[model samples]
Target: MNHAGPSPVPSIFPQFFAPGNGPTDFIVQDFAVVMIVAAMMMAITYKLKQPMVIGYILAGIVIGPFTPPFSLIKEADTLNVLAELGIIMLLFVIGTEFPMARLRTMGKISFAVAIVESTGTLLIVFFAAQALGFSFFDSLFLSLALSITSTVVTIKVLEDLGWIKSKSSTLVLGMLIVEDIFVVTALAVLQSFAAGGGEFSLPGLAVSLGVTGAFIAGVLVLGSRYIPRIIDRAGKTNDYALLLIVILGLAFGLSFLSTGIGLSSAIGAFLAGVLVAESNSAAVARILTLPLRDMFAAIFFVSIGALMNVSLVPMFIIPAAILILTSFASKLLIITGVLVRAKFDNVTALRAGFGMSTARGELSLVVVKGGQDVGAVSSTILPLLGVITVVTTFLAPYVIRFGNKITLTETKKSDGSSNMEESSSGVG
Candidate 1:
C-alpha cells in the first residue's frame, strides 16, 4: 500500500475534470444546463415549501468545487457579466417602486437609519478585522463588503408581499436607497486608495463627488423632460417603445460617464429610473420590463450559482456567516431605534428592520470588485458575493412574509390617524 512514488491529489470532483483539467468543457455544454439542474432542485424544494434560494445556493455547492457530476462551469466569465447586467435591471426595478416623493416624505429617518446601520456594521467588522490582525486594506475591504444590505432584494420582497405601499415599506425603501449610496461611497473611497500613493486628495475626491452628482442631476432633469415624449412616440411606431432607444442609450452612456465622476454606473441607471418614475412613462417602463426582468434576472441568479467555488467556501464561510448575522442585527437596531423613538409600534419597527436586511445590486458587487482590483480582497470575493446575493435574494420572500404578518397582527385598527390602517406611510 505504501508503494506509491507520488500520492493522488484527492479530488473533490473527479468526473468533471481530468484530475487537474480546467472547467472549459462545462461552458461548451451550455451554462443553461448547469442552471437547469439548479432550477430543478429549486422547483422541487419550492414545491416542498422550503426557501428555494437555499436550494440555488446548495445547487451552487453541489455543482461547485466539490460535487462530481458537473464541474465544467468554472470558466463562466461571460455568464457572470450577463448576471451583472441583471443587477442593474434589478435596481432599475427597485427604483421604480420608490418614486421621488417617497424619498422626500420619508424624512431623515430613512437616510439616517441607512447611515447608522451601514456605518455601525462597517465599524464593527472593520474593528473586528483589525483586532484579528488583518492589515488596513484587508480590514477596509472586509468592512465595506460586510456592511452592504440588498436594496433590490428588500424592495422586491416588499413588492411581492404587497407591502410596498406601507409606511414601513417607505422607510425600508428610503433607507435601502441610502444604503445603496453608501456602498457606492465606500467603493469609491476604496478605488481612490487603490489608485496609488496618495492617502487623500481633495481635488480628486471633490471632482469625483461633484461630477457624479452633476451627472445624476443633469440626467434626472433632462430625462424628466424628454423621456415621456420619447416613450409615447416610440410606442406608436417602434413596438419596442418600452425599451426606449433614447433612454437606454442615455442610461448606459451616462452610466459610463458617471464612472469618471467617482460614481458607480448604477447611480446613473437608478437616476434613469428615478427620472422615469417621476414622468408619465414610469408605468410604461415598469409594465414592459416585468417579463424581461424575470428572464434576465433568473439568468443572473443562475450565473451566480455557476460562480460558486467550494474551495473558497473554507475562507468565506465564517466571514459570510458573521457578516450576514451582524448586517441583519445592525439594520434591525438602527431602523427600530429610529422608529421606536418616533412613536411607532414594536411590530412595525421590526418589519421596517427586516425590510432593511436585503442588499443586492451594483453597489455590493462594486465593493467586492473594487476590493479585488485594489488588492484589498482576494479574487474569490467575487464568487462569495455571488453566493451572498443568491442566498439572500432567495431568502427575502420569507423574511418579507414574516415581516408583513408581524406588522399586521400587532397593529390595532387606526384611531383617528391620517395614516391608513394597513399602510405605514402618511403619503400612501
Candidate 2:
C-alpha cells in the first residue's frame, strides 16, 4: 500500500474564503449556506407546529457551537449588515401595512398598557436582580436589556399571522415602539452615565436628547411632504420605480448621522421607517425590496445564529435561567396588559403574550453592542446577553404557536378583524 502524505481537506470555515473568492463573494457563500439551512429549518418548524421565527433561531443554535455542527462561522460583520437590513425592512414593512391613523386610534390602550407593562417590568426586573445579589449596575443593565422585546421579531411574527389590523396587534406594535423609544433613551442615559464615571448629568445629557429630538422633528416635518414627490418622480422608470437606492442612501445616511451625534444607528433606522411611512413610497419601497430583503433576511437570521457564543450557556447557568424567566414574564405582562383591556379573551391575551416574548433582534443588540463600544457594560455581559437572546428568540415562536392555536379555536369566527392586509408586495 502506498503511504499517502497527510490528506489535505478544505475546512468549512476557510473554504468559505479561499483564493479567487473575494471576501464579499465568500460572505455571500456563507450567507447562502446559513439562509438555506435556516429556511429549511423554518419549513420543518412549520411542519412540526412551531413559529418560523423560532425555527430560524433554532437552526442557528443547532449549527452554532453548542450542537452537532459546532460550526466555525465567518463574515460576521457582513452578516450584521444584512441583519440590520432585515430590521429596516421589518420596520418599513410594518409601516406599509398599518397607517398612522390606525396606530393613533389604538392610542389610549397602547399608551396605558405600554406604560404599565414597561414601567412595571423594569421595576420588577431591576428589584429582582438586586434581590438576587447582582451589582447595581448589573441589575440595571440586565433589567434594561431584558425588559425590551425585539420590534424586528414582534412585528414579523404579527405580520406573518396577518394580525396587524387587529386592535391587539396594533396595540402590540405601539407597545413595541414605546419599548424601543424607552430603550433608546435608556441606552443614551447609560452611555452618558458610564462616560462620566457612574454619574449622570441631566444638563449635559440634554444635548444628546436635543440632537435626537431635532433629527426626528426634521424627518417627520420634511419627509411627509418631500418623500411623496420623490416617490412620484422615481416611479417614472423601472430603475427609478424601485427607488431603493434612495431609500438605502437615506437610511444609511441617517444611521451614520445619528451615530455622529452620539445616539445609535438603529434610532436612525427607526426614524427612517417613520419618515418613509408618510409617503405613498411605503408600498413602492416594499415592492422594490421583496426579493432582496427576503434573501438577505434569511442570511441575517443565520448569521445571528452563527454569532452566538453557545459556549456561555454552559457557564452562566443560573443567571441565564433567571434572565430568561424575568424576560419572559416581563414581556408576557406587557403584552397581556395591552390585549386584556382590549377585551381579548384570556386565550388571545396569552397568545399575544407569546408572540411578543422573543427578545433581542436588531435594536436590543444595538443597545448592548453600543454599550460595549462605548464602555458601558463589562465584557462578560456581552456573552451573557447573547446567550439570553438566543434562548428567547427560539422560544417566542413556540409560545406564539400555542397561543395561536387556542386563539384561533376560540376566536376564529368571533373576529375576522384581526387579519391585517398583506403586502401586495408579496407576503404570500
Candidate 3:
C-alpha cells in the first residue's frame, strides 16, 4: 500500500506557451470574442446614425456573462483590466487638450455650476431614494453615487458630435473637473465614516482632504515645471518611436503614482497629459496616441456594459425607473438653471445640461463598490444602479443630438434676424 508515484516534472517553458492547455488561451479567446462582437455592433450603430459608443456597449452586453444564451467570454476580469487601460488612455488624451491656463480661466463659472449641481442633485436624490423605501445608508450612497456626472461618456459623445472644443464643451469640461474634486472629498468622507463604524470622523476627513489637495498641487507644480522640458528634449530627437515611448511612460508613470497615493489613475494620467501638452512635442504625442486611445475607449465602454446585470432588471425595474427619472430631471433642470442664472445663453446652458446628464459611468460603479467593501451598501441596490446606468448611457447620444437641433434652430433664427435688420437699415 506504500507504492510511490513519480514526481511530476516541472516544465522549463513558460506556462503561456504550454501544450494542450495554455494559461493565456482563454484570454486570447475572450479578446477575440470582444473584438468581433464590438465590430459587428459598432457597424450596426454606425449605419443607424448613432454614436459607436452605444454599439460598443451593446456588443459587450451580448458577450457579457450576465446575458442569456450563455456567456461568450470566459475571462471577464482580464477584459476589465483592459477596460481600465481604456479609461486611462481616454482621459489622458482629454487632459492633453486642457492646459492649466485654460483650466484657470474656467474657475469662476465652473465652480458655480459644480457647486449648485452637486448640492442640488445630492439633496434631491437622497430625499427621493428615502421616499422609495431605501435604508438611510443606501439612500446616502445612492445620492453620492448619482451626484457626479460621467466625464468619459459626456466627453466621448462631445467628441463624436464634433463639439469637443466648443464654448459649451469648455464649460462642461470645467464643471466636470470640479465635480471630480468633489468626488475625491466625498469618497474620503465616506471612508472615514466606514472606518469609524458609521460614526463621522472629522479629523480623518480633514486629513484625507488635506493630503489630496497637497498631492494635486504638488503634481501640478512639479510636473508642470519639469516634465515638459524632458518631453521637449525628446521631441528634438525627431524620432517618432522614441517620442511615443516617452509620452507613454509619462502617462502611465504618473497614473501609477496617483494610484499609489489612493487617488484615481485617470487623474494622474490626465496630469501627465497636461504636463506633456506644455511641451513643443504635444502635437506629435497627440497624433501618435489617438489610435491607441480610440481602441481603449471602445473597450472601456464595452466593459461597462458587461458589468451590468440585465437579469436583475425585472426585479428592480420600478426603483430603477424612479431613480432614473428623478436623476435626469434634477441634473438637467439644476445645471441649466444655474448656467442661465450665471448669464450663459439659453442654448449653451441647455446643451451643457444635456451633456452632463448623460449617465453614471465608471465613477458610480467605483463608489458603490467602495460602499459594498465597507458593508454600507446592499447587494439589492446594485441591480437597480445597473439599470439606471444602462438607461442613461443609452439615452445620452440621443439627448445630445436633441440639444444640437435646438442650438441649430436658435442660431439660424438669430442669423436671419441680423440679416433682416441689416437690410432694413440699408433701405432706410
Distance (Å) between predicted and true CA of 161, model 3?
6.4
Which regions of candidate 2 fall more than 4 Å away from where they truly are? Answer: 1-29, 58-71, 74-103, 130-141, 150-170, 184-198, 238-242, 331-362, 379-383, 390-428
Checking candidate 3 for backbone clashes, the offending pairs are none
lDDT of 2 by residue, 91-204 (tens): 444344444554566567666766677677778888987887777676777777777888766666667677667645665677776676677656666665655576656776
Model 2 quality (TM-score): 0.73
- In TM-score terms, candidate 1 sits at 0.73
Model 1, span 106-160: residue lDDT tens = 6776787778778888888788767656667767776787677666556656666
Between candidates 1 and 3, the lDDT winner: 3
lDDT of candidates 1 onward, in order:
0.62, 0.63, 0.74
True-structure lDDT of candidate 3:
0.74
**lDDT for 410 (candidate 1):** 33
- The top-ranked prediction according to TM-score is 3
Could you tell me how far off, in angstroms, the CA of residue 417 lies in candidate 1 after the best superposition?
Answer: 13
Given candidate 2, what's the lDDT at residue 83? 60
Sorted by TM-score, highest first, which candidate order results? Answer: 3, 1, 2
